[model samples]
Target: MNGQVNARAGASGKAGEKVLIADDEPNIVVSLEFMMKREGFHVLVARDGLGALEAIRREHPRLVLLDATMPGMTGFDVCEAVRSDVDTRDTRIVMLTAKGRETDKARGVGAGADAYVTKPFSTRDLVQTVKEMMARDAAE
Candidate 1:
C-alpha cells in the first residue's frame, strides 16, 4: 500500500478521540486527513455539508474541521444544529473557509464555532490549533 495512510506503528489513534474533516475541497481533505492522522487522531472525512452532519451524528467526533459553505447544509447551518443539540453541543468546531472578513468570523462564532480559520491559513498553525483545542477539551 504505497502512499497509503497508516497510523505511526504502535501509536494507535488517541483514545476516545476522533476528528471529522468536513470540506468540499479535495486537496484540503487530503491534507487535513494526513495531518490529523499523524497527530494520533482517528480521522473521518465528509465531502459536503449533509455528509458532514451525518458523520457528526454517527461518529460523534471530538472535533469538526468544517468548511463554511457546501451543498445541502452549509457549515453555518451544521454548526447551529450541533450547538442546538444537547448531545453535540460540546463538540468543538473550527470553521475553515476562504471567508476572512470580520463579519464572516463573527458569523462563524455566532453559529457556535470555537475557532475560525480562514483559508490560506498555515497548515502548521491549523494542526497546532487542532492539537491545542482537542487536548484542552480532553483535559477538561
Candidate 2:
C-alpha cells in the first residue's frame, strides 16, 4: 500500500486502497495481484466466485475486479449478491471478462457492477478504470 506504479497511459492507483481481484485463471490473478500491489494498493485474490465472496466478506476490500466466468458462482451472480447485501452494496465492483458482447455488458450492469473491462485489456485501461472507480467511491 506504499508503492507507486505508472500505468502505461499515465494512470496511477490511489495509495492505501484495498482491491480484490477474482479470477479462475492463475496467471491473470497473479498478474493483476502484482500490478495492483505495485500501484500501492493492498491486494487480495480469489480463484473463484465463492472464494471471491468470502474474501470480500472477510476483507471488505474497497474495490473488486471480478472475472465474469468462474465455478460455484458466476461474476454476475456475485455482483447481484453483493448489490443485494446491505453491508457491501455500495462497494465498488468492476467486471473483467473476455466476453465483449453488448448483452454481456448489459448483464454486468444489470447485476450492479460499477464498471466493466474486457479481457486482453490494456494494463493502463485496467489501472485507470480502478483509479476512477476508487475516486468515485470516495466521492460517495
Candidate 3:
C-alpha cells in the first residue's frame, strides 16, 4: 500500500498508541512507517509541518518523528506550537533531520523536541529511541 497506511481509524498495535511520521521525503516516510508498524505502533503520515501539527492535535499520537525542514512550516515551528498548546504539549517529539549541526540540535531542543535524531541514523537505534520514549511516557 506504498506504506502510507493511515492506521489512525483503527489502530492495530501496542494498545493502539499512534506514532506520526512527519517527513516530506517519500522514501524516508515509507521506510519509517514500515519500521514503526513492525515495532507495533499505529502509524500516521504527514508530508508537511502543518499536516503534522493537525495530526498531532486530531490523532494525539503518543510520539511524532518530525523532520526539521518542511513546507508550510518548519519542524521547529510545529514543535513550538505543539509545546504551547495545552492539549498537545505532552506529545513526545523526536526531531529527525539532516541538519546535524550543534546549533540545529540546540534549536530543535529549544523548540521543545523531546529528542533530536540526525539523518543517516541507524534504524535499530531510532526504533530503540522511540520505544524508550514511548515506554517512559507509559511509565509516567
How does each model score on lDDT?
A: 0.84, 0.81, 0.87
Q: Which candidate, 1 or 2, has the higher TM-score?
A: 1
TM-score of 1: 0.90
TM-score per prediction, in order, is 0.90, 0.86, 0.91
| Model 3 poorest ten-residue lDDT run | 1-10
lDDT of 3 by residue, 1-140 (tens): 22232554323475547899999999998889888888778888988888888888888889999999998889999999999999999999999999999999999999999999999898789999999998888788
Give per-candidate clash totals. 0, 0, 0
Please rank every candidate by lDDT, starting with the best. 3, 1, 2
Mark the 10 consecutive residues where model 1 has the least summed lDDT: 1-10
* Tens-digit lDDT string for candidate 2 (44-124): 777778888877776778899999998888999999999999988877899999999999999999999998889988877
On TM-score, the stronger of 1 and 3 is 3
Model 1: per-residue lDDT, tens digit, 1-140? 11122223114686567888888888998888888888788887787787887778777889999999987788999999999988888899999999999999999999999999999888889999998997798689
TM-score for candidate 2: 0.86
Give the distance in Å from residue 124's predicted Cα in candidate 1 to where it truly belongs.
0.9
Sorted by TM-score, highest first, which candidate order results? 3, 1, 2
Maximum-TM-score candidate: 3
Candidates 1 and 2, the one with greater lDDT = 1
lDDT of 2 at 19: 88
Residue 59 CA displacement from its true place in model 3, Å:
0.5
